[model samples]
Target: MTAPTPGTDGPSIRPRTAQHYSVAPVLDTPEGYVAPGMPGVPVTGYDPGTPTPHRRKPRRRTGLALLLAPLAALLAGLAYGCAPLRAADSLGWLTIAQAGLVSLPLGLLGGRNRLLPPLGALLSAGALLLGQLIQQLRLVHADTTTPRTLLQHTLTSWRADLRPLDLAFYAIALTGGFLLTRRTATRT
Candidate 1:
């Protein structure tokens, strides 16, 4: 079969039967080649199911959110900068290390990637637990109290400190969720 001429909607495939030769060569598509409901599918018959030619839509990205990722990372870095790492005690340094570790996930998630959020959550939670331990250690060192009393003081301190930091995580999670949802809605 001879190919159709470029640009004209014509049949490029030749029909086996002699009857189709009289028609012009322009009907290349099923819709164009075969007339609707024709018997034996005339070489000229156009198929209805072929997709229409179209340009693809462009990809969308979260420009603003992506931009904010660095800022979030900086904030986490600042938290580390503020920590009392130079203190003589090992536990004090541990508290700072934990805070820094927890902040890393937040910084990572802020950037363009998938693993950051889960890692951030894991690190943050771990850091919080370690921070509690540091607080308990400090309490134990400061007081002449029994083990139970030291544990109680640590728990109390954790309750006060942990909630705000945990709340920040919730906020980051919510913000990221909202941004993704908004992008999807716009795409559809």
Candidate 2:
């Protein structure tokens, strides 16, 4: 064989030519064409001839919200009731702190969805009410106090037990939870 030229390969090495296919115009039919091997009805692509429909994504976590809402409320009520029994005089402004404790789990569990804030507020209020009721029942049971007398006593003095400051604290906690949870959700 003759000497190969500088930087040149033997005859076996050859340049490749790209292969091309002819394009066919898509045909529109009264009955839409279905993709092969796909089951059920034929789904259509966007077409000027066909009307576009509005579709909404189904909401998730509805059942979870329902379950957790009540659970959070019950837990908050239990915490409120039990706090005083643990140390009646010690929990003063610390009662305000209890609002955070109650709201944190609620926000974390319920997530940062639109429904959670209002639900949390409602639940917190219910928890406070329940706590009062529980406290009254316990007092009555322990002291052998008459139910009618205890009921009257609680009704009159419930406001003292659940002070306006405590309500404000709970409100603040709920709002904080909502904002914090929303932020956390967005970051992920």
Candidate 3:
């Protein structure tokens, strides 16, 4: 600081040197007051209630999952049919891939836990079971049979044709789809 300087009327003060401080952003202030901003600090436009351009609006996934579940299950069924049913080692990666892939959209589009996992599992089980029945009818009997009779026959004989890892693969697919497809809970 400079000493006081003499003026015509009275002693006048000399200008003091500017003070230096480290640059830091100030967030807290008195009500209705905004603190001084520091240089080189970028400001954000995000507000509590305002929607961001990058954030997609949260939506219900049930409708889309319901629509696509059947299709995905059908594909899995077709793939299952192609595998050697007698000594099948695995359900084939395609079935597992389809199940997991179908679940991705459910996770990405929706928020929080819902019925999607169980619903997908149910659809998949039904299609796979029905596929087994149809395949047995086409290959084993090759005779004209009523739907009810065919279903009953498959029900009785399905256990006989069960492969070593059939249940395990099915379980893996279902579990993978469920766990891998879980959605995050949205606050807004």
Q: Model 3 Cα RMSD, Å?
A: 9.3
Q: Write the per-residue lDDT of candidate 1 for residues 1-188, one digit (tens) a residue.
A: 55776458754465545656566776457554655568765555468799889877544444543454344434544453344635423332333344344434334334434544444444434443444456445645586478787777777765765545555544444344333323323222
Q: TM-score per candidate, in order? A: 0.28, 0.48, 0.53
Which ten-residue region of model 1 has the weakest summed lDDT? 179-188
Better of 1 and 2 by lDDT: 2
What TM-score should be assigned to candidate 1?
0.28
Model 2 residue 77 CA deviation in Å: 1.1
Evaluate candidate 2 by giving its C-alpha RMSD to the native, one decimal. 12.0
Tens-place lDDT per residue, model 3, 3-114, is 5566765666666567566976665777765444866545687577986579765677656656666776676676666667674434444445656655655555444556
In candidate 2, position 45 carries an lDDT of 71
Give lDDT: candidate 1, residue 91: 33
Task: State the lDDT of candidate 2 residue by residue for 1-188, as single tens digits.
Answer: 76555467654434555756587655675576566667866556747887778676434454565576677668767766666665643433443343444455545555556766566556656766676566656655565477677777766565556666666655655565445434433212
Candidate 2, pairs of clashing residues: none
lDDT (0 to 1) per candidate: 0.47, 0.57, 0.60
